[model samples]
Target: MKTTFEFLNQLTKNNNREWFQSNRAKYEDSYNEMILFADQLIEEMNKHDVIETSVGKKSLFRIYRDVRFSKDKAPYKTHWAGTLRRAGANRRGGYYFKISNEESFAMGGFFGPNAQDLLHFRNQIALDADPLRNVIESNDFKNDFGELLGEKLKTAPKGFDKTHPDIDLLRHKQYIIRHDFTLKQVHDPNFPEIMSEAFRKMRPFLDCMTEMITTDLNGIPLV
Candidate 1:
């Protein structure tokens, strides 16, 4: 079984469509191998009795990068991303981890326009400063994101200062957690285990956010 790191490294070096077409066998083999890895991750989470809403569904594995709106458009991407979803779930989102030399990380979240629903979400976290602090100051969160996100969190929009009473509150409001790691070290034999460990460790925060947003009519937290 090829590790995720290997699959991603191969992808980065062979990014073009023609390259992919010529090496179709490698792509297919890697895709199937990743599916198995994802399955093992699901099973491992299940063993720990994690609360997951999506399972036993088709996961997509593709090399195409849709850059219709981007200024620096690239015909293709030298990376791989995939997701697993469940049927009949209005709150549909999935976990995705991207592998590339430039930007590589595991991220899972829902995206939406700046509608009333989203505005309400922003207001919810903005209003209740304490609960938001509870989330940010929690030991688990500190361990997972404190080092990586400290600088970003410290410098919010112009209006909000880090020392502001609501600064920590705003930190958890309508934001995304995108943590990066060193790619060279991520290819080691222990990389998959480390990645899985990080995901599992952050599961509680993901679950808590999901539970909080479940009562909302237009929001669904990603895990």
Candidate 2:
């Protein structure tokens, strides 16, 4: 991981294709390191949670940059990232981690849920927000993610009441729980376990939201 971090730090300075091509060996080394790290992360995740993501290098996202649409056309990514999905239809939410010199974090939750899912979440909050509140307001949740995050509308979201008690939770378009890591933290010897523990803390919120989204307004299972 340290070697990977050093490689990414240099990548920030030399983002051009020419430099990347010239240093392909370094890139490969860093990539392999990330793959090994991701494999270990999956092992750690499965100890406390059911992970559907494949083991080994398959868990790691490609380092190549897609320059077709973006204005910044750097040929390589400056960080190594992996995403893990919880196993089974009943299990909802995702796990993500990125290692970089600039920003590194272990994040989980509903990133961009569909309209139907959003409606269901809001309905649950409107009907009874105690369960959701209990999860987010828990000491472990507060210590880990600080608070529920992601984009929100300033005003009421369509039919929801502006003065509703749980309007703050309903206004969210995305429910994201994140724990950012400092460079020192990323470079720690036990970073894989450390990051996995951060992800484990999201279970309460994930379980709460999964129940909300998987059930109808009548409190029956949808799947």
Candidate 3:
């Protein structure tokens, strides 16, 4: 794990193709270490939520960076990332892990839902804010993850009044809970357990969003 962190720390400084190809062995070693961790994490996650082994593979993000649309043309990413999504659920939401020498975090929620899904998410909030609020406000959830973090509309979202009690919640474009960790913490043998507990505590939040996005009430998806 420490070696992995060293590789990424150096990669952050030298992100070009020539340097990367020269150090391909190091990258491969680091990537394999990450994959092993992901595999273990998937197993732990399955104990709480049904996640396919294939999801572990799908979860491990590619290290290459798509430089076509970006101003920064670095050929590779400085950090490794993975996601664990529900086995049969749509890809709109999942638990994500990103680690670098400098920083790392565990996070999950609905990110970039389509217009219809986003609308339904808001509608879900309007209809039953208690479930969502209760999860976010619980001491365990609050202590682990400070607040629900995401982009918000400057004003109220359409069909939602500004004065609504849960206006701030409805204005969100994404709903996520995140907890940052240091390199020291990630290097600990208990890191996987730490991550599992974090995800376990967040079960309600994941369930709330998953239900909203996947369930159909009447003809339309609830979220």
lDDT of 2 by residue, 1-223 (tens): 7788778888899999888889889898998888888888899999999999888587788989999999988888898888898999999999888878788999899999999889989988999999999988989888888999999999899999999989899899999999998877777878789888888888889989999989988899999
RMSD of each: 5.9, 1.5, 2.7
* Candidate 3, 1-223: lDDT as tens digits: 7778889989999988899899999998998888888888888888877775464566888999888999998888989888887666542467888888768899988767778889988887887788788889989888889999988899999788999999989999989889888767899987877787777777788877777767664436533
> Could you tell me how far off, in angstroms, the CA of residue 101 lies in candidate 1 after the best superposition?
3.8
Off by over 4 Å in 2: none
The best-first sequence of candidates by TM-score reads 2, 3, 1
**Candidate 1 at 120: error in angstroms?**
3.8
Per-residue lDDT of model 1, residues 74-101, tens digit only: 5566665555332333333245566655
For candidate 1, what is the TM-score?
A: 0.64
Q: What RMSD does model 2 have?
A: 1.5
Q: Which scores greater on TM-score, model 1 or model 2?
A: 2
Tell me the deviation in Å of residue 164 in model 1. Answer: 8.4
Q: What is the lDDT of residue 200 in candidate 1?
A: 60
Candidate numbers, best lDDT first, in rank order:
2, 3, 1
> What is the alpha-carbon lDDT of model 1 when measured against the actual structure?
0.52
Q: Where does candidate 1 stray beyond 4 Å?
A: 1-14, 49-57, 71-73, 84-94, 109-117, 147-173, 179-193, 215-223
Index of the highest-TM-score prediction = 2
Clashes of each: 0, 0, 0
